[model samples]
Target: MLILTLVIVQLPQILRQVQEWRYPRCYAAEVEGWAAAYDLDPLLIYSFIHTESSFDPEAESSVGARGLMQMTEETFYWIKSKIAPDEALNFDSLYDPDCSIRFGAYYLKLCLERYGGDIATAAAAYHSGWGTVDALLENGQYTRDGTILAEFPYTQMAHYVQKILERYQCYTELYGS
Candidate 1:
């Protein structure tokens, strides 16, 4: 019991240390700009960034997602042509907070639009791909009432959606609205 109490007390300090060590420039201006461009809530973009990369500009996932937003190389290339046609895209720029946040916000907007702004559906599509989500919905695999029912396949992605939602709630409470 004593050890557990000590660990619980120290966990917040450890998390604070981690946050300070991993602090990347917020890039709020860039995030807001991209959010406006894509008609998304700036707070949602912020929450996504926090959840995806924990504000680590240089973060790279084992699957090769890169930068503050953990964007895939293919996604970066695709968005570069659409949103930054004249600018040459270098993979190294993925570590730039501004560039990464911009691309991520744009991608989230695209997903939101594709999924009709249903956060759960959009999140699931983002994690598991749109085709899978669409097929599940189209074939009545999911209920029309909009609960994340257990009948849905891709348990990993279902959990991912839950995590994102939980993180978003935390971000809202921490940052306000």
Candidate 2:
């Protein structure tokens, strides 16, 4: 009876530990360094990574997105031009956790800045593209204001945003001060 009572009392904490293990912060140094440099939340970037690749550095999507943050070749080159203009880096470098975290955090910062710090809209832009999010913003049915999304124009993108936000919340709760 005492063992059963103790187990019941410890259930919540045990479950939380399991969740924390599930969302492991695999590349902590890279994540922290890039996130700090970009002035973005580390947990938010972690959530983005979790949603994109589940922390698998070599993960790839059917659409050809690759690495931790799952950037397509086009997006990688665009970011590369801005951040590593002089480097002779290739698309395969996205598999390097350090490079991926830097570029991903930088892109997240750009998206956040573009959407006036609205995570939902920035996440939508990350999942789709800034152009698509901008067009959706122009439709009254999608956004109540010019900067924030009231309703995601596409169901798939909406779910992506939800997953990002949900993981962000979980990461914050587990590790935040």
Candidate 3:
């Protein structure tokens, strides 16, 4: 009875943390579709989405990234031109499950191509921008293995990398690779 009480007491925090770390079902389904469409692992897609927005469809970053996939305005516009030119897309559309996931998957496909199918490098590029990744590589600050040393300048990028990794582990455990 004491153990049960203790467990119940800790449940909310645990659940909250899990909520912050996992994608919701609607977002997961969209991610799965995108992964299938692009030949990406669904677990990887989930990890990215989990890290980006914690499955919040209305999420918007300070840098103007929006929705479950946290896509930037420019990328959204580019995707709109290529995929949905006749359809109108605004910040609200970014909160729509299908549009956000499609754009996110498309960007991931682009990154995978750019980074030669290296997930870590591609993810880093996605978070830090390709230019930053390129400059870091050019200056020998990052390696092909995706190892960035402790002295790396961008703490946000580093944290982003770590969060994705952690979320990926959770995704694998929850859904398997």
Model 3 alpha-carbon miss at residue 111, Å: 1.0
> What is each predicted model's overall lDDT from 0 to 1?
0.75, 0.92, 0.77
TM-score of 1: 0.75
> By summed lDDT, which 10 consecutive residues of candidate 2 come out lowest?
145-154
Structural similarity to truth (TM-score) of each candidate: 0.75, 0.95, 0.77
lDDT, model 2, position 157: 96
Question: Between the candidate structures 1 and 2, which one is better when assessed by lDDT?
Answer: 2
2 versus 3: better TM-score goes to: 2
User: Which tens-of-lDDT digit does each residue in 1-177 have in candidate 2?
Assistant: 999999999999999889989888889999999988999889999999999999999999999999999999999999999999999899999999998898889999999999999999999999999999999989888988888898886889989999999999999989992
Clashes (backbone N, CA, C under 3 Å), per candidate, total 0, 0, 0
Residues 1-177 of candidate 3: C-alpha lDDT, one tens digit per residue: 999999999998888678654444456677778899988888887788778887778899999899888988887887788778888777578888788888888888888888777676677878877888777766655564443322346788777878877877776766568
Q: Indicate the residue-level lDDT of 170 in model 2.
A: 91
